[model samples]
Target: MRKILLLPFIFLPVILFAQGQHTLMDTLRAQLEIVFKADQQYRLPLEGMAKKYGWNSHQVDSLYEGMSIRDSIDLGIVTHILDTYGWIGTDSIGPSGSTTLWVVIQHADPDVQKKYLPMMRTAVAQGRAHANELAYLEDRVALEEGRKQTYGTQFQLNKKTNKYIIAPIEDEPNVDRRRAAIGLEPLEDYARDAGIAYKLPASPPAKPAQGPDKNP
Candidate 1:
């Protein structure tokens, strides 16, 4: 599945935007942004060239972008930063940087995500990270297995239409309430941005508590 940088303000903004004094998460977010953007910017070009020619096709032009070993190396650095410096609060890194962590972790190995999610989730509770960040992570972990996602962060690319389709999520009946609690806008907004059609329930069910995932 092709994953676009679906978390709003999550990709290019990290490069153009500035944060408060370089706290641990702020610095880590910047590094992670660089690597993740590289992956996004180049992965497609690399794949196109690979398909047209072949793997390790040295004849390929430099303009074709592809993921490199450097990505893994940098992910290790960010992981170390998270593990060592501990969770930085939303007060410190703000929403953009916190979302940057979500993007970074999204690209990391599943094992790495599993290891750091609890810490990241705690940061969300402490107001270090956005609750939306934890939600995005939960959705990603579930989407990896084709299970129902909790926060509706996952999207799938339609090859025939060349469009992005919002993936399945759990508790569709109460998705918006869950979304609002975590600082996310309505599901329709997200789906709209990706050019997907979304129809809300005629009326939402009872609201869930305004909390992050129960056990992300």
Candidate 2:
């Protein structure tokens, strides 16, 4: 008589691998590391161009135009893979993959983000993922689809008008509560990090009353 034992294999296509087991998360971390580096590679050039050609110059616009297509494609492919694999969290993939996923989602175009939002929301609801991803995407989706953002990440300055265009937040009064629920810092802190001057709108001057004139 002989006895045989079988050993488990290290799977490559797993979605919920724990930290440091050479699983799918390694691939995710590797791919996103390259992506993050590529993103940073443009920063110095952009800053130099801004200094030389002016911040709002046509050259900057051209740079953005060229990058937009590549950025969209990169995000599209990555997000598609993510959606297929289901949402992975810090508990499953460890800090590297978790941080990389967050960065990728943040850099992704709003449309791409909206496309993957359902999976992310599911993860949150299932207690496998953090709520911040959902909160961030909710705001991005609202801005792109012309509704109120819930987390307020879509602020921009209109260069021509020299005014801020803040994406509306639903229930502005308790926005901090929503943010806290999702593990985000105070709105003021986030605004400062994003370089926004959150201000209360100034009151308009009262209109002068018109006087009645009588013809004699």
Candidate 3:
């Protein structure tokens, strides 16, 4: 009977730990999805973002493949145009050293091509914009990760006090730090604002005094 009763105690903690970890992972992934949406809006490539996150190319490709139907269509249009018409060749350069090939090749019936050219140009411009936006997103992701690590360390230290049940830290700094830095607050208050319980570390212990120096 005692063994069966004790078994519940052991399993209970294991279950709770697993549940907490799952919640934290889900929250992190939700934040990542927001970042991914911003990238999609700007037509950012996922290759570099994947590499920055240490994900394999196959994983990155899978993510892009799984995008929503609307996002997939936009990406498809941009990629196809770049593949078909984006080339620049030395042979097409004019005597003045400017390449007229793109303009000439794109010329169809004056009314039709003129209407489409601006849309094509916008696609090209968005593609270039994507490169810059992806770079910014990569930096933002890295910064968020570093913030989580810092907050985790602080949380662990604060755990010594029973007053606080430290919650999983977020990746973003303004959110994580501002919440964690709130001085001497209860766990529920932090959880309400920051999506997690948090507490600052208790003050450090006083250093022991050095013994009087022995005469050399």
| lDDT for each candidate structure | 0.71, 0.69, 0.40
List the pairs of residues colliding in candidate 1.
89-128, 90-127, 90-128
Q: What is the TM-score of each candidate against the true structure?
A: 0.62, 0.68, 0.21
* Sliding window of 10 residues with minimal summed lDDT for model 1: 59-68
Ranked by TM-score, top first: 2, 1, 3
Q: Give the TM-score of candidate 1.
A: 0.62
Off by over 4 Å in 2: 4-23, 43-48, 56-62, 158-161, 199-216
Model 2, position 195, has a per-residue lDDT of 64
Residue-by-residue lDDT tens digits, candidate 2, 1-216: 122232233343352355445556677667767766655555547877888999799998777775676566667656765866767766756555555565567677666677677877787788766677667767877777888888766686688978766667777767778788878887778777766767533346679998887767
Ten consecutive residues with minimal summed lDDT in candidate 3?
92-101
Across 1-216, the per-residue lDDT of candidate 3 in tens digits comes to: 999889989899999998986675454335334434533543355546676764566656566565444344433433343355442122222211111222221222234333434444453354322222222222233333453322332332245554433434444333334334533234346454644554445545679999999989
Q: Which structure among the candidates has the greatest lDDT? A: 1
Off by more than 4 A, model 3? 44-216
Candidate that scores best on TM-score: 2
